[model samples]
Target: LLCQILHCLLILLQLVEIVLFIVDSGCSKHMTGNLKLLINFVEKFMGTVKFRNDQIAPILRYGDLVQGAVMIKRVYYVEGLNHNLFSIGQFCDADLEVAFRKSTCFIRDLKGNDLLTGSHGTDLYSITLQDTNCPNLICLMAKATSSQAWLWHRRLSHLNFDTINLLSKNDIVTLHAYFATEGIHHQTSIARTPKQNSVVERH
Candidate 1:
């Protein structure tokens, strides 16, 4: 019974960390407590705003948000806010449309495809979101690949053709000799141009 009680407590704590953000059409930007995205900083608040009971809130620039397929750019970090906020204007800026009806709300992309849905909270519709910066997950900008040469192209840290060919010829790696032969010839031909400086070619 004690173990089960402890497990429930852990689950509650995790659920609290994954906060529910209210969809606020009046808000100018997305605001959160501390859950930041991985984007660039914009600017800080010029002054503090007083909430209920004269509680002062200082707004700061937060990072971006990129999930499996969605992206929220330039969020705000509100240290004093306990609840998260999503701005309708920001969503519209990103070409997303929001539909609110009765007690439920839906966020859709430019094509009207559903991206997220939220239920009505105490005063507004809210959706739960996890930050990409969370330690449990890592975000990377990459594309799909199936070719062995293209696969090696990334694994070898984008090394030049001649160096990659040398490694393959000397059996330093398991790469096939002909894998980059054509590409190397094309690269060599391009390198002859004066604009292809040594500094640019090294990479």
Candidate 2:
């Protein structure tokens, strides 16, 4: 009964080439991805697999527990196989239940809510899971800002407000002082050229 249900789940699962997994109840371990590529694999064990003609094939045990989105633990590694093998015994060990009908498989959570569903594939059942891409903490933060006073100082073509303030405080560049410094004896009504006053006239 367990094997039938698990087989249905595997047949219905949508998966890509990178994560093709076989649902094998007879297999002891939930075989994971390529052993040589996975960094977390440790504790290698020598396992022997028997085939139809009593042929035995040596297997390597690379056990790992996959949690979060799809929860499975103690998965092995098979070198030559194109797909990983999921063990129904492991699912039973985890106390999870699978239901199948109408060529579809449904995995339920502890509360009896449907966790995942998969449609039947053409040849067999294959499960495909969704992957999420989220931004890290540093990328979500806003950039730092500069002071308004410093911004205005630069916008005025590097005019030094400190020097201007000092001159005004001491009355060094008052109206009379400015006129005398510029060598203008009296105020003259001089008209500025159109091009020179164009920017001021726009406002």
lDDT per model, in order? Answer: 0.63, 0.51
Model 1 error, position 166 (Å): 41
Please provide, for model 2 over 67-151, each residue's C-alpha lDDT reduced to its tens digit, 9 standing for 90 to 100.
Answer: 2365455666655555666666766677777666667766676778775555567744555543222222221111223444344
**Which residue pairs collide, candidate 1?**
37-64, 39-64
Residue 15 accuracy (lDDT) in model 2: 25
lDDT of 1: 0.63
Best by lDDT: 1
Q: For model 2, what is the C-alpha lDDT against the true structure?
A: 0.51
Best candidate (score: TM-score): 1
Clashes by residue pair, model 2: 10-125, 11-125, 11-126, 12-125, 13-126, 13-127, 14-126, 14-127, 14-128
Model 1: per-residue Cα lDDT at residue 83: 68
